[model samples]
Target: MEIVIPEGSGPIAVHGFARPRPERAEELERLLLSFVAPTRAEPGAWQYQVHRDAADPTTLVFYELWRSRDDLRAHLAQPDLARFQRDRMHYLREDLEIHWLTPLTAEAP
Candidate 1:
C-alpha cells in the first residue's frame, strides 16, 4: 500500500522503514498488515499504508498522514498501535527509521 501526503502545513507526514529478523519475517509481516484497517478507520488519519520490499522480503516500510501532530499522537496512543509497538521489535532486526515531515510543496494530477 501507499499514501501520498497533500502539500500543506496542517497535516503531518510520517514515513518509516523496518527490517525484521529473518526468522520472524512471516510473523512480523502479519502483525504489520493488521494495522491497515484500524489505522485507516482513524478520524484523523488522512492515509496509511504498509509496504514490503521486493528485493528484501524482510524489509518493511510505511507511510502515514495525519490531520495534525495531535492526531498522530492519538494514533500512537491507540490500543492497536500499542500492541504493535510491543510486538514489532520482538520480530525486528534493526530499529525503525521514522521521520516526521512537513510538506512544503507537492504536485498532484
Candidate 2:
C-alpha cells in the first residue's frame, strides 16, 4: 500500500544514507531502528522507514515524508534526533548524506 500524503499539505520527502564504522554496524542499526516508532508517531510524519543496503550491510538508508517543511524542521529539533546528530560520529564512518526530494509523480492511485 502507498502512503496518502494529504492534498495541499506541501509534503516534504527526505532521503538519507548513513554508513557505520565496520565494527559499529550492529550498534548503528539498533540506534537507527530506535527512531522508527517514535518518528512515525510524530504529528506530521507520513512515513518513516529504515533499510540496510543489500550489497553493503554496513550502509543504512532512511526515507521520510513529512507534511511540510515546518514538520521536517520540528522533527530535526526533537531531542533524540538532536542527540543522535551530536553523537553520530561514534557510530558513523562519515557524515550523514541527506537529500531533499520532490515528487515527480501524481499522488498514489
lDDT of each: 0.76, 0.81
Q: To one decimal, what is the Cα RMSD in angstroms of model 1 from the true structure?
A: 5.7
Highest TM-score against the true fold, candidate: 2
Clash pairs for candidate 1:
none
Which regions of candidate 2 are displaced past 4 Å?
A: 1-9, 105-109
lDDT tens readout by residue for model 1, 1-109? 2223344457788888889888988888787888889988888888889998789766898998777777777888899776777666688787777776884552221
Give TM-scores for every candidate, taking all chains together and pairing residue i with residue i.
0.80, 0.84
Question: Which regions in candidate 1 have their CA more than 4 angstroms from the true location?
Answer: 1-9, 105-109
Q: List the residue pairs that clash in candidate 2.
A: none
Q: Residue 44 in candidate 1 has what lDDT?
A: 81
- Residues 26-104 of candidate 2 have per-residue lDDT tens digits of 9889989999999998888888999988998679999987778777778978998888878888998888888777655
